[model samples]
Target: MKQSLYIYNNGDLKRKDNTLQFTTYEGDKRDIPIERISDIYILSEMSFNTAFINYISQYGIPLHFFNYYNFYTGSYYPKESLLAGQLLVKQVEHYTCYDERLVIAKEFIKAAADNIYRNLRYYNSRGKDVAECMKEVNSLRKKLDHTEFIEELMGIEGNIRKNYYKAWNTIVNQEIQFEKRVMHPPDNMINSLISFVNSLIYAKTLSEIYHTQLDPTISYLHEQGFRRYSLCLDVSEVFKPLIGDRLIFSLLNKNQITEKSFTKELNFLHLKKEASRLIVTEFEKRMKQTIMHKELGKKVSYQYLIRLEAYKLIKHLIGEKEYEGFRIWW
Candidate 1:
């Protein structure tokens, strides 16, 4: 269980022999143990030398970066250790064949929609009155089979999400009036949480993909483009409802995060430094929480579930097993 290290201050990260060190601008200094770290997230301004990059690459550590507005800019991914040309060809074949691509794409959307429905059901049974929202999403989900092109599939997914977002108003505390999902400097607290948490899931998925033989750029749901890992985006869609959205509803409903926990400047809304750290802490905890997995006949941590999802995709690509998106049963 490797922990992720997050730095929110302006600092210099350097390699100190076999260890890592961070020196803040205020003249404070500290040492970070490299062995316990799996990934490093730099959320503020920072500088590092080539030597530091080489050090992390030696251990295949991922370095994720976020801009001032809390948008995920990019990642310094180490060279692939599990590169397999055989798997890469199979992955590409799935993408190039329209029937194969559409099948995988549909699984992604169906799993996402099912996960969203489970969330609404969970709250509705707990007295949230989310039945109407759930019904709308379910209706759009049935139309998924009628979609032929990727664009049409995406349209159905988008409308499903639109209705799903509406259910948040009933599930969350009254203070959060989530009209719709908005990014590019999220207009409200819920959207801000969505943007930040979704980015974390994406990065975590990318890191998981690195452990496998899959090329992260080749994807089905999202277009494969340079400077981005689109396959992670596809895999993350299935888990966001289980991980990101559930944690958000809990944080708001339980009063762990409130309207006062955010700071808005102009059109940009971001969590306060303390609030941001709190969400990160909670998210890590959620990822580490284990649940009984029927398929494995044992409990698996939420983080490992993401990795498992990747392994399943690889198996599908190689024709070892038929792929099905992970859905919540409990």
Candidate 2:
């Protein structure tokens, strides 16, 4: 499998002959073969020469940039030829119909809620009092299937997510307390970790969207406009609870990510570049970890699980099959 390359430090990325090389400020050189890379994620202040950009474009590779605060800036997407006009029309057609769009949107929320419940159940089996929290979220989730309007469905989804977030501290098996979910300037270690992980999951979803024939700008759940890839946001909502939030709880509880990994600037808390990279590395590792897919009856990696979700959506759009998003049961 072609994997993603992450560059954090200020360095020069250039193509020498046919291979890619990164030269650090300390004059150390590391080379990577061009064929082995799928995408490049830049998490810190970095510079690349024309040769690097040109060669990446030749391979149709995308370079996504993030600022010091770990917020995504923009992407350097290469001009490519993988778009399908027929699929685009079907995507818009699905979005324009209220009944069609609502059905799809509700499924995403339900799958997300189901996964949130799965996380709670997994921990509860090991003796945590998550049943009360799960009951609240499950009640909110039931409203999704009955929602008549798009906004109402979205609201129900948000309410269920809030209840799911409330169960995190209880599942962590630690004494650290969480008042509320915070982002932008994360007030605590847990929030900071969640912010970083969610960003990675969003970017990963964007990458998956890019490869599909579906337009990322058009989405059912989120209002499509401006520079926002609304479809990516829609798809990301389904996986964040299962992939990103679970990782945060596990890492913090295990003491793998500690206070020493973060830095405070003024009132804003942020993870250092090294710390962010560590988290990203672990996230990619988790994505590669295999599990017995209940429906498939075989082991599948988490990363492929995400791609399968996208494929299911595409199938729904093109009328191949009814797309019921992945619901977590185990």
Candidate 3:
């Protein structure tokens, strides 16, 4: 399996024949066999030549960029060789049908809610009094079926998340507090981590969607236009709790990360490069971790699950079957 390459230090990345090489200002150099690299994430200051981009494009390798504040700015995605005209038409067809689009969107929310409940239940079984929070989420879950507009569905989703976040302290036995969910500029460590993780997950999902011939620019749950890949954002909702939020709770409660890992300036909080890399590395580790998939009756890694989710979306687009995002039954 191809592994992702993360570059977080100052360096020069260039194409070395069929391989890629990274050389530091201090003169340390290393060559990476491009075949073993699926994606490259640039987290810190770095320079790359056009030759490197051209070489990576030949192999369909994407380059994701993050700023100093850990905010995802954009990506350089290689043109996919898997694009199909029929699949693109199917994707647009689904988006154009209100009832059909809402059904898929609702399924995404339901699966997301189930995963959120699973995470809560995981901690609750360990003695957290999350029953009350679960009850609130249950109420919101029922509202998904009754939602008439996208905004209404989003409101209920937000309410469920609010209830869930409130239960974090009890579930994790950690003093790490979350005042609220902040995205524009995360005001605290928790918010900062949340923003960064969600960004990565969104981009990862987009990359997966790119491989499936689905137009990532078209989406049902989130309004599509001006945004590059809004459909990935729509699907990422289902996995954020199972992947991103769970990792955040684990790292904070285990004392793996703390206030020291954050830097505050003018009320804006950001994870330091070292801390961000620590979280990203752990996230990548989680994606590589395997779990028994009940439907497939076999073990699959989190990364594969992501790709599977994208495949499911494509299946829905092509009218092969109704799309229901993955729900946790265990």
Candidate 4:
């Protein structure tokens, strides 16, 4: 698999004759072979001419941008290559039909809640005293099947996640206090990590969707709207608990990420460059790790697991099989 090329310094990006080159403002330059990159990430100040943008577009490589706060800003997505008009129509049908939309939406919530339960159970088995939180999660999750409307289903999903977040406080070290899920300048260290890592997962999901036939803008769980790819948001919910939150728990338990890694600017809490880099490195490591997939009967990288999920969605759209959001068994 090609790796994601991350640019995190002030630089000028330009084409280097079948390759990509970044020249830092300080006069340091590095070359990245175009064939070796799955995507590109612009994390710091950089300037690139139109020639470079048009060049990468030829390969359909997505460019994800992040602001200084390590918060995801947007992406320069190239035109979709896997544009199946039939699949697009089917995708819209799924969203337009209330019962059809609700089924898929509820499936996403069910899988996400199950994955969250997996994390809590893993900790509880180790004697973390998370029984109270687990009880709340189980109670809320049971409502998924009974929910009649998408709105009500989402309510249960929200409550389940809230209880899941509360369990984190008991699982991690006492030095870090994770009272609840907070964003809009994430008030604490754990919150900052949550925003930063969740953005990566979202971007990663979008990139995987680009390779599949399903339209990213047509989604069920999240209302499809302008200025955002909502399908990525729906697919990402399944993996965030699996990939993002699990990594967060591990980092905190091992003290790999500390409060020192954060900086407060006005009312916003942002991660320092070193801290952001550390988080990305750990995330990349986790994506490269493998698990034995019983259905596939082989080991697959966590990154490929995401692409497989996309393929599963496409199959569901085309009526080849049912779409069951990925729920972790191991």
Q: Tell me, by lDDT, which candidate is best.
A: 1
**TM per model?**
0.97, 0.93, 0.96, 0.97
Q: What is the lDDT, from 0 to 100, of the residue 147 in candidate 4?
A: 91
Model 1 lDDT, residue 262, Cα: 79
lDDT of 2 by residue, 55-152 (tens): 99888688888887787777877764577889889889999998999889888888888888888888888888889888998788777778899888
Q: Candidate 4's C-alpha lDDT? A: 0.88
Error of 3 at 277 (Å): 2.3
Cα-based lDDT for every prediction: 0.90, 0.81, 0.83, 0.88
lDDT of 1 by residue, 46-135 (tens): 999999999999888999998876779999999998999999999899999999999999999999999999999999999999899989
Q: lDDT tens string, model 3, 1-330?
A: 898898888889999888999998788999999999888888878888888889999988888899888889999978878988998888788889887778878888888988898888888888888999988888889888888877788888899899988887676555667757877777777777788889889878876776677777888888887368888888899989988988888887888888888775535466787888888889999989999998899999887888898888887777687788887666
Give the lowest summed-lDDT range of ten residues in model 3: 262-271
Clashing pairs in 2: none
For model 1, the stretches where C-alpha displacement exceeds 4 angstroms are: none
Per-residue lDDT tens digits of candidate 4, residues 1-330? 699888889899999898889999999999888888888888999899999999899988899999988889999889988889998899998888999899889998999999999899999999898999999998889889999998899889989988998888888875666777888768888888899999999999888889888788888988777238998999998999889999998888888888777775433377888877888889999999999998999999898889999898888878899999898988
Clash counts per candidate, in order, are 0, 0, 0, 0
- Winner on lDDT between 1 and 3 is 1
